[model samples]
Target: MASSVTILFLLLSIISMGGALASSKPSGSSDPLIGEVCSTQSHLVCTNYDDVQATSIAADQVATAASMRDASIQTINDLQEDFFLESSLVEGRKIAIHNNLNDPAPSRPFVPSSAVSSLPELTTYNALDIMSYFGVARDSSMATAIVTAAYLCGGAALPGEAKSCAASTKALAAFVASELGNNVSIYATKGAPTTYSTSTSHVKAPVTILKVAKGSVEEGRKIVVCHHLAFPSALYYCHAVTGTKVIQATLKTEGRLRAAYIKAMAVCHLNTELWLSRHPAFKALNIARGDEACHFLVENDLVFTRALQTSG
Candidate 1:
């Protein structure tokens, strides 16, 4: 795995090239930034239960990371703290990016109408040059967080899929409304959105997951999965998918009472055919052709579906 500095420069080179570093395609290969980051944190990817659970922890979480989504969900408060609240910067930056969709990697988040001030412009010759330009320490968490967000936002869209990065709750609402209409509800993993820990190996498998006795299990239609991003402020990389099914299940692992994890264990069953044959879900879940590969939503991910039955 390349160091964060290494990943940072990779993003810089892509920015300098000013081409499509990534497509809406989910394959790691589709996006260079995603590919490098995924390679660094292979354990966190959407692999099988054993692989995901057994994987070690990373120093920091990647935004829109191609990670395996399972495990101890974090608390809502933990999720809420990252937002910028009413800051106009969030909406301003997002709108700017949406307007200039073709600029695969934007250095400056310029907005003429925005009341916010101009932000620093990012540029570089290679991955390392940018790190040196910013004086970002090799161990700096920002090395990945900022660059990851940059690539995720600037990357291309998948066929028939619409994506956006919302830096605030208001911006998110607008994006969701634009994509799924107003009559929608968002279901996220209940409790705190937690990451798997070296200490909490107790949550690992060797336990059976009973029927999805809770949450919504509506027929396929339009569904949105918003992944929380790591940024200076709260940001989410959200994408809309069609013909996907969502559910919130509670598991009975090893006869222990359900942990106070996610309020609703939202799950998504991606259409297998539409996905690449090598998608982590396919290999991890042993999915057969023409079948769906279902997996738990990441702790930080939120699901937006038509308000079928609210998971209160």
Candidate 2:
């Protein structure tokens, strides 16, 4: 019985060894099936379980690469769209400016006696003269004066018209106060209005006025001085100044007219500056186009962003 048991154990051991040899892969041997499955240069050994895992990993990598490529393309497309939109806005502003420059001057209504009466007597001063008197440079102060004059006169007074210098200076002071607040100093004459005060720090003006005889030739032919304190620049009697009349006439509501006039004057003043004229964005815009472009930009906030992008 013992000998029979020993023979059975030996037979079981030999069967187990044969099964292990059949399942194990030889170091130097390549399977025809594995070569066919792994046809690429990777030379990966393929088995039923390992082949599925390898294929899954490869597919995941391919999907990841494709997704990355697609995302990159989408990002590029978005950037291109943004660039085109900005470029179109810039072009539109340029065209608007050009058209405004070419348009004929608008007719202006006669200055009312009330407006004329409120004006104090002023010396005949051009843009440069006003800048000199104010002790400001030719760049921004001249523009501000022109805009201020237009606003105070309600767009009726011209540079050559008989207007009050004191009144215009007051208008300039008010303008500075409104826009810049306490950035400047203003000295008031005793018992006079704040507007009649002279500015000490930034704006300088003569205390004494050249008295003209009631019947003198200078009485009715008084010096016309209009300033835009916003621009701080001087302007001659031109369409930009006169165009404020168009705003007053076209708009039915007083509030709307005032708002439109302010916006238009701002553009006009900006156009007068040498830096703005040479600005890449405003290179195509000139003084002639100031009125229309200003209105257009004010109405379209998006376009205004493009116009003033480089202003800062």
For model 1, the stretches where C-alpha displacement exceeds 4 angstroms are: 1-139, 192-217, 252-264, 288-290, 309-312
lDDT of 2 by residue, 143-255 (tens): 34433343333333333222322222223223333332322211100111122122221221212111111111111111112221222221122111221101100111121
Q: What is the C-alpha RMSD of each candidate to the true structure, in Å?
A: 20.1, 41.8
TM-score of 1: 0.51
lDDT of 1 by residue, 1-312 (tens): 633121111121111011212222233334322232123344112121121111122333332231311112121112221111111212112211110111112212111113112223221112232334344543556555455555556565555578886643435556676777655655544322122342222233322222343223455678777776554434567788786656543322232354322222344444546554444544544556446544444444567766544368
Worst 10 residues of 2 by lDDT: 299-308
RMSD of 1: 20.1
lDDT agreement of model 1 with the native: 0.39
Report model 2's TM-score to 2 decimal places: 0.15
